[model samples]
Target: MKQSLYIYNNGDLKRKDNTLQFTTYEGDKRDIPIERISDIYILSEMSFNTAFINYISQYGIPLHFFNYYNFYTGSYYPKESLLAGQLLVKQVEHYTCYDERLVIAKEFIKAAADNIYRNLRYYNSRGKDVAECMKEVNSLRKKLDHTEFIEELMGIEGNIRKNYYKAWNTIVNQEIQFEKRVMHPPDNMINSLISFVNSLIYAKTLSEIYHTQLDPTISYLHEQGFRRYSLCLDVSEVFKPLIGDRLIFSLLNKNQITEKSFTKELNFLHLKKEASRLIVTEFEKRMKQTIMHKELGKKVSYQYLIRLEAYKLIKHLIGEKEYEGFRIWW
Candidate 1:
């Protein structure tokens, strides 16, 4: 598998004939093979010419950018190489038709809620005393199928997440004052961590979606809007509980990430470069972790699972198979 390239230092990235090269401000140079990179993550200031962009674009490598505060800025998505006009139409049709759209949207929430509940159960089994939160989440999940409108469904999802976040206080061993989920400049360490890690998951999903024929902007759960890939938001909702949240839980419980990991002077809004690198490294390892896939009768990495979700969506759009969101069976 091709690995993701992360740049956490000030540098200049240039296309060196067939390969890639990065030179730091101090004049240190390193060569990178273009074929070995799946995607690029820029966490610091970097400069590259059009020739570099053209080379990466030719190979369909996306570049995800983050601001100085470590918040996601945007991505440089390459042109679609695998375009299926019929599939695009079908994708739009599903979004335009309320009933069809609701079916896919509900599945996303159901899978997410189920995974959230599973996380609580995993912790409760380890004596984390999250049983009350588990009950609350389960009750709210049942109401998902009964929601008549999209608004009602979203309201239920919000409640389910609210209760899920409540359990974190007990699940984590650290003395974190995590009461609720907050974005738009997360107020606390937990909130800041959530925003940063979830952004990485969204970027990874976008990269996986690029390899497929699906249009990233067209989505079911989240409304399609300008300058956004809403389909990634929809697909990532199902995996965040399994991939992102679990990683957060592990990092905290094991004391791998602590309050000291963030910049206290920045109101805990800024994650230091070392902390960010550690999170990305652990996340990459988790993505490469494999589990036995029942349907395929073989093992598959967690990263491939995201691509499988996209393939499943394509099958649903083409009427080859019904869409069923991924739920943890392991």
Candidate 2:
């Protein structure tokens, strides 16, 4: 499998002959073969020469940039030829119909809620009092299937997510307390970790969207406009609870990510570049970890699980099959 390359430090990325090389400020050189890379994620202040950009474009590779605060800036997407006009029309057609769009949107929320419940159940089996929290979220989730309007469905989804977030501290098996979910300037270690992980999951979803024939700008759940890839946001909502939030709880509880990994600037808390990279590395590792897919009856990696979700959506759009998003049961 072609994997993603992450560059954090200020360095020069250039193509020498046919291979890619990164030269650090300390004059150390590391080379990577061009064929082995799928995408490049830049998490810190970095510079690349024309040769690097040109060669990446030749391979149709995308370079996504993030600022010091770990917020995504923009992407350097290469001009490519993988778009399908027929699929685009079907995507818009699905979005324009209220009944069609609502059905799809509700499924995403339900799958997300189901996964949130799965996380709670997994921990509860090991003796945590998550049943009360799960009951609240499950009640909110039931409203999704009955929602008549798009906004109402979205609201129900948000309410269920809030209840799911409330169960995190209880599942962590630690004494650290969480008042509320915070982002932008994360007030605590847990929030900071969640912010970083969610960003990675969003970017990963964007990458998956890019490869599909579906337009990322058009989405059912989120209002499509401006520079926002609304479809990516829609798809990301389904996986964040299962992939990103679970990782945060596990890492913090295990003491793998500690206070020493973060830095405070003024009132804003942020993870250092090294710390962010560590988290990203672990996230990619988790994505590669295999599990017995209940429906498939075989082991599948988490990363492929995400791609399968996208494929299911595409199938729904093109009328191949009814797309019921992945619901977590185990």
Candidate 3:
């Protein structure tokens, strides 16, 4: 269980022999143990030398970066250790064949929609009155089979999400009036949480993909483009409802995060430094929480579930097993 290290201050990260060190601008200094770290997230301004990059690459550590507005800019991914040309060809074949691509794409959307429905059901049974929202999403989900092109599939997914977002108003505390999902400097607290948490899931998925033989750029749901890992985006869609959205509803409903926990400047809304750290802490905890997995006949941590999802995709690509998106049963 490797922990992720997050730095929110302006600092210099350097390699100190076999260890890592961070020196803040205020003249404070500290040492970070490299062995316990799996990934490093730099959320503020920072500088590092080539030597530091080489050090992390030696251990295949991922370095994720976020801009001032809390948008995920990019990642310094180490060279692939599990590169397999055989798997890469199979992955590409799935993408190039329209029937194969559409099948995988549909699984992604169906799993996402099912996960969203489970969330609404969970709250509705707990007295949230989310039945109407759930019904709308379910209706759009049935139309998924009628979609032929990727664009049409995406349209159905988008409308499903639109209705799903509406259910948040009933599930969350009254203070959060989530009209719709908005990014590019999220207009409200819920959207801000969505943007930040979704980015974390994406990065975590990318890191998981690195452990496998899959090329992260080749994807089905999202277009494969340079400077981005689109396959992670596809895999993350299935888990966001289980991980990101559930944690958000809990944080708001339980009063762990409130309207006062955010700071808005102009059109940009971001969590306060303390609030941001709190969400990160909670998210890590959620990822580490284990649940009984029927398929494995044992409990698996939420983080490992993401990795498992990747392994399943690889198996599908190689024709070892038929792929099905992970859905919540409990």
Candidate 4:
């Protein structure tokens, strides 16, 4: 399996024949066999030549960029060789049908809610009094079926998340507090981590969607236009709790990360490069971790699950079957 390459230090990345090489200002150099690299994430200051981009494009390798504040700015995605005209038409067809689009969107929310409940239940079984929070989420879950507009569905989703976040302290036995969910500029460590993780997950999902011939620019749950890949954002909702939020709770409660890992300036909080890399590395580790998939009756890694989710979306687009995002039954 191809592994992702993360570059977080100052360096020069260039194409070395069929391989890629990274050389530091201090003169340390290393060559990476491009075949073993699926994606490259640039987290810190770095320079790359056009030759490197051209070489990576030949192999369909994407380059994701993050700023100093850990905010995802954009990506350089290689043109996919898997694009199909029929699949693109199917994707647009689904988006154009209100009832059909809402059904898929609702399924995404339901699966997301189930995963959120699973995470809560995981901690609750360990003695957290999350029953009350679960009850609130249950109420919101029922509202998904009754939602008439996208905004209404989003409101209920937000309410469920609010209830869930409130239960974090009890579930994790950690003093790490979350005042609220902040995205524009995360005001605290928790918010900062949340923003960064969600960004990565969104981009990862987009990359997966790119491989499936689905137009990532078209989406049902989130309004599509001006945004590059809004459909990935729509699907990422289902996995954020199972992947991103769970990792955040684990790292904070285990004392793996703390206030020291954050830097505050003018009320804006950001994870330091070292801390961000620590979280990203752990996230990548989680994606590589395997779990028994009940439907497939076999073990699959989190990364594969992501790709599977994208495949499911494509299946829905092509009218092969109704799309229901993955729900946790265990």
Top TM-score prediction, candidate number: 1
Candidate 1 overall lDDT versus native: 0.94
* TM-score per candidate, chains pooled: 0.99, 0.93, 0.97, 0.96
Query: What's the lDDT of the predicted structure labeled candidate 2?
Result: 0.81
Ranking the candidates on lDDT from highest down gives 1, 3, 4, 2
Give the per-residue lDDT of model 4 (tens digit) for 1-330.
898898888889999888999998788999999999888888878888888889999988888899888889999978878988998888788889887778878888888988898888888888888999988888889888888877788888899899988887676555667757877777777777788889889878876776677777888888887368888888899989988988888887888888888775535466787888888889999989999998899999887888898888887777687788887666
Kindly report which residue stretches of model 2 are placed more than 4 angstroms away from their true locations once superposed.
265-268, 294-298
Q: What tens digits encode model 3's per-residue C-alpha lDDT throughout 1-330?
A: 578999999989999989999999997999988888899988999999999999999888999998876779999999998999999999899999999999999999999999999999999999999899989998999999888999999999999999998888888875677787887668887788889999999998988888889999999989887337999999999999999999998898889888787776544376788888898899999999999999999999999999999999989999999998999998
Error of 1 at 3 (Å): 0.6
Better of 1 and 3 by lDDT: 1
Tell me how far the alpha carbon of residue 153 in candidate 1 is from the true structure, in angstroms, after superposition. Answer: 1.1
Alpha-carbon runs more than 4 Å astray in model 1: none
lDDT of 3 at 246: 95
Candidate models: Cα lDDT each: 0.94, 0.81, 0.90, 0.83
User: Considering summed lDDT, which 10 consecutive residues are worst modelled in model 4?
Assistant: 262-271
The lowest-lDDT stretch of 10 consecutive residues in candidate 1 is 219-228
Q: What are the per-residue Cα lDDT tens digits for candidate 1 across 221-281?
A: 8877733999999999999998999999999999999999998998899898899999999
TM-score of 4: 0.96
For residue 39, what is the lDDT in candidate 1? 99
Ordering by TM-score: 1, 3, 4, 2
Comparing 3 and 4 on TM-score, the stronger one = 3
